[model samples]
Target: MSLFWKESDERGHPSLGTVMRGVVLLAFLLGGWLPSSWANQVWEFVDGEGVTHIGNVPPSAATRGVIWLSRVPPASVVKGKDRGPSALQFPGYDDVKQHLEAAAVAQSLDPAFVIAVAAAESAFNVKAVSRKGALGLMQVMPATAERYGVAARPSSDGEHAAMEPKVNAQIGTRYLADLLRMFDGDKELALAAYNAGEGAVIKYGRRIPPYPETQQYVEKVMRFYRGLLR
Candidate 1:
């Protein structure tokens, strides 16, 4: 039998709890007979359907699997130490770019606009979590997650979900597209609405909200978008 575990589904967007449980179960199964050194090398993947598989290799959904495996350090290590705090890196740059381009084109939005939003939302920090519990690189809130058909209770740390960079970018870009549509494609108004709710922008007659943070946030993202284009 192949040492690797395979889930029924091809997509690997499994629930966090499911993945954690799978990891534990795999440890138990292999721990009994395997050498300590061998046990340390076990790996697992949870499918989109929340089924967990244990193995030496990941399923096909893990196209760039070996890279992730190699990069994974001890759980005790902190991430992003080499890169400065503000400069976060995307795990799958090509995947993120592909999805962002598609979403922007479909929504008639400037691709830089979507990228800028992602930058501001989480500084491209896939593991970013807002104090209010927003999760992933997009910092998607729970209600927003439900609306987007994402998991209602995504992992609080966002590490696992964020690692699936394409998914996070797609959700974030789509939400921005919706805001743009709602604001009649006025990028500034849409950005303001994104930072400070559509209702708030509407109430303010499409002006940036009075909230200082929201106002600054809108301006900052737009400035960054402009810079990216230049």
Candidate 2:
């Protein structure tokens, strides 16, 4: 993920003198920015080459070097816990249970299987977005959205139809149900199609593709589902 910070003036063009003044002001501001609330919670580490870095936790690069600094207080703690599900706690567990039960009742599929699919797809992250621009909890892609009557609008305020958790889940579950039907209730084939695509799976003669990522993704999701059962 990329994060951006604005540190410059908004003017498109500034005189050289103004730019110099701005740089000086920025330097002063940065100098005074130390000993902040987060200082105590922040830590610093040195690499093998003696280059130092400051962060909330030891930098991953420190593995190549001896410990220059152990766990130190952060300058400040972000006062909140992670709002997402863990390996143990699935978000919206009750709602997922209800939805799975309803799906199983209506489609004659297994509720545990549906839950497993949800676990694999988004880990219940309602705002999950895949690299291919799939959206919402179940990661419904644009073409699939169109096939399932999900409206694709420009991503903006009031264009949140696609982001609604229930809408996304409903459409995703329905699409999965269709895939299940297409594969004649073969869960493996259906899952493979979900991860890769139905066309790819069909072209490969109903087998998991030779692509390593797709194959591993299918297997991992199945493993997670199986774990849920146990």
Candidate 3:
């Protein structure tokens, strides 16, 4: 009844892992039915022994519990990337407030929007980490970081560049500016695209995505932005 043929544990036959790898290779060669994004087409599932597999094919391990693909966009490729901050530093809201304001000014946006986003995203927490792997005050995703030229600090003690307040504010503000421009200065649509994905916005006819989380996120951020105005 298994989606994948089982391997005998006692006899040590080729494992379900091995079988799935072969199938994945074949699928790679065929390339027609598989999701063709460079985002790894990753499917994660835990095996009976609690071993996790992230690859193109799902094995019998999927029966244990949940299995799903992480459709995060592939990191944009660039040749000869510039070096990130060689020496990283951590600063709190008070110390970094001026930088945030400067970044917003450079982007020709209201400082309140940046402050509100940072507040809504991480409550100004310097070390915040999202379940979806977003890091720092702006909760920048790796793909989004890559798009906005944010990088991990070279000397960080396990902290990403996005977790560094100054860097995150700068890059995140630039990203918001780009989104606003893309949506033709529509704050609602831009915020929606920021919460969901630009592709999702386009898919939904240039409106907010249908997901409840994103809808609420837009509203919450707007509320925060408004409160900052007063």
Candidate 4:
């Protein structure tokens, strides 16, 4: 699940500074650090410290902190989109399809599934970065990538080398495979771990955690996966 967990206080609460830093960093990334092309009218939501979301439709009621890039409002945006949720597109998916396939094959995983996860995670944005510091097409954290044998070298852009498309796919697919094995080949639990951290899944008795972000993530990925399969 988590590439590396943030330190918590004696009472098992994340430090206030850590939480604040994440919020500020998210604002910076969304507001400016990312490419202007990513500024599409998107609806987003943040549930706790999990990876942020950008989808065509509004998030579920269980979610909090809905973020809108436009004054149009989430409901209005969704209603205006004639193509519906399926209208969500992966902008650069074609560019990294080969890498995704290679990594999936190397890990004995379904390439469609791997691609779906990447699509859901980053929309195939090679330069994607999350508030929790997850990066690249697969959004693998640097520490977690290192744990999977991907060395953490800084790129010229200040992003970690693990963010490199090929390397990120490799580490991410490997991690997914491990999570699949850990959960006895259950893709749902594996995905829940991918979104919410493996420890969170175990803590919740190997079921998908109740976090709305994680629940929606699993559903979205599987939906993408099924679409890919067809």
Task: State how far residue 61 of model 1 sits from its true place (Å).
Answer: 52
Backbone collisions counted per model: 1, 13, 0, 2
Point to the candidate with the largest lDDT.
Answer: 4
Q: Candidate 3 on 1-230: residue-level lDDT in tens?
A: 21222221111111122223212223332222344544244343335453434453433332433333222121222364322210111124576577678889999999988876665455555566654576666667777788777666676487776777777788878888999999999998887777776778999999998775576557656755655554
Order of quality (lDDT): 4, 3, 2, 1
- Tens-place lDDT digits, model 4, residues 29-132: 33223345543444443436543344433344544443322211122223443221331344566789899999999999999889888876766767766555
lDDT of 2 by residue, 95-181 (tens): 556655575556667766776666556555565554356766566776777787877676656444656776776767787888889
For model 1, the local distance difference test gives 0.52
Query: Which ranges in model 4 have alpha carbons more than 4 Å from their true place?
Result: 1-88
Show where candidate 3 strays beyond 4 Å. 1-95, 153-156
Quote the positional error of residue 146 for candidate 3 in Å. 2.2
Q: TM-score of predicted model 2? A: 0.58
TM-scores for candidates 1 onward, in order? 0.54, 0.58, 0.58, 0.65
Minimal lDDT window, size 10, model 4: 2-11
lDDT of each: 0.52, 0.53, 0.56, 0.64
Candidate 1, pairs of clashing residues: 4-55
Query: Which window of 10 residues has the lowest lDDT sum in candidate 1?
Result: 67-76
